[model samples]
Target: MANVIEEAKSGRASCRTCKKTIAKGELRLGVEQMTQFSDTPSMQWHHLLCAAGKLPGELKGALAGYEGDVPNRADIDKAMTDSIKSGKAKPGAFPYIDKAPTGRAKCMQCDETIEKDSWRVAVERELEVNGFMRKSPGYMHPKCVAPNLENVGGTMEDLVSQVKTNSLIDEADMDAVVEEMTGEGGGDGGE
Candidate 1:
């Protein structure tokens, strides 16, 4: 089933975005997900505004098909527009490229701190946290991406394709990332 925008049937379902209860009869966005336990996909509910912020593209498509009234259509539309332009990916949607927002993240390949304001490649990695294994975003320098992907089961070509499809960065930034990842255009050849 596709994603949908509809009213909450009950207050029991807490929004996946904010972890708050969606008051009964309030508008919510449901993103369809497939679980291993069930053949039928289930819907993950989020508060309408929260979905607009975090899942802009998905929410925009769902909103297009929704026939009911929306409480703050103007605000939600503006937020979705701004979010799409921000070049940030939805939470847990990896294999993208974005500028490092902070200097604290270290490259998974070279283990060096990624400087803030520089472009970085983000990929999904499995991590064990408090005895539970889950997928999380891992950061790497663009120059380190080829080698990292070699060890992690993807080629530079595959990575470049995924980054191009998944990233929201503008054309110029995307070109630079591709050049660096592919060791072309004086990118030190993944040194």
Candidate 2:
């Protein structure tokens, strides 16, 4: 399928990522795909920045194809660059951590509260399937990392290193994460 990025011809398009209108004459990204229910082609529209973030590879070529000046072209390019550094530019596996940013989540392993601002290990978890299913990203307590890592075939050291390299983490902060997992930081290690 062909991917194209150009200014909106009409003000009716909504960004697939942000669900906001793309004003006429503003740059928009149009991802072409066959309609889900039909062989006819369709376009998914997103604002320039939204597309750059969600479709980094497509953006590189689409930008090359557009004839007019792209606003914040550098910013979008940087977002794509950062996404590459952060392991989000492509889709595979690169687990990491973040402060719960919110406390609405529970640990998939132990089913306990993941308190706000507490560090969470993001892991791709698979379901009980007879065949194959796409794994879902879920949160786990640092204490619960061991069993889950065994289940998912990854190592804590690898995960920690990945988080450090792909994210803005402090040396001391990651050290604390280690200490927590090893039971040196307190709380029965992540019990």
Candidate 3:
């Protein structure tokens, strides 16, 4: 028997939804597969929320056009099991694992303050290959985490834009300023 969980645990695949590299020894949201009666075979791994986002469109007209509420872990697990048994989904087909919270000062995406006691949803900016990927953890304050994330939209270009817009001084201007300071007797006590 093929064990998808074991495969994912060994780092052979990744999440299709988030496009992030899933590694071994990580806790995945779970695997899922769906296929229409006549449609070609398709399967994917999702990052819980990412899977939820796709459900409405993926279910098509079968679903009554209503966005459902948040589902518990058990609900997703059952769905995964059902899909696997039906051969529509295979285990370890889609690899995904929600990264664990790391104690960091501010949200990397928005620079918001974080509380020390609990874990808040945060977007990790500098994700590494493994061994303690650096994260920008923060309080997120419930309301702010989602919208702020939506607005910022975690991209290298967005961060670069933020850095360019929030500059202290231009490089040329800084050079001139430094020259002026250095020319002033070097601030030495010789005189």
Tens digit of per-residue lDDT, candidate 3, span 72-119: 546654554344344333112111111123445564345665555433
Quote model 3's TM-score.
Answer: 0.21
Residue 167, candidate 2: alpha-carbon lDDT:
35
lDDT-based ranking? 1, 2, 3
Q: Can you list the residue pairs that collide in candidate 1? A: none
> Model 2 — TM-score against the truth?
0.46
Over 1-191, each residue of candidate 1 has an lDDT whose tens digit, in order, gives 37788888988999999999999999999989999999999989998889878987667667757888898999997887688887664532457788889999999999999999999988888889999998777999998987777554677776776666556677778888799787788644432
Q: Which ranges in model 1 have alpha carbons more than 4 Å from their true place?
A: 1-41, 44-54, 57-82, 86-92, 128-133, 186-191
Better of 2 and 3 by TM-score: 2
Off by over 4 Å in 3: 1-3, 6-104, 126-139, 151-191
The top-ranked prediction according to TM-score is: 1
lDDT of 2 at 135: 68
Report the Cα lDDT for candidate 1.
Answer: 0.80
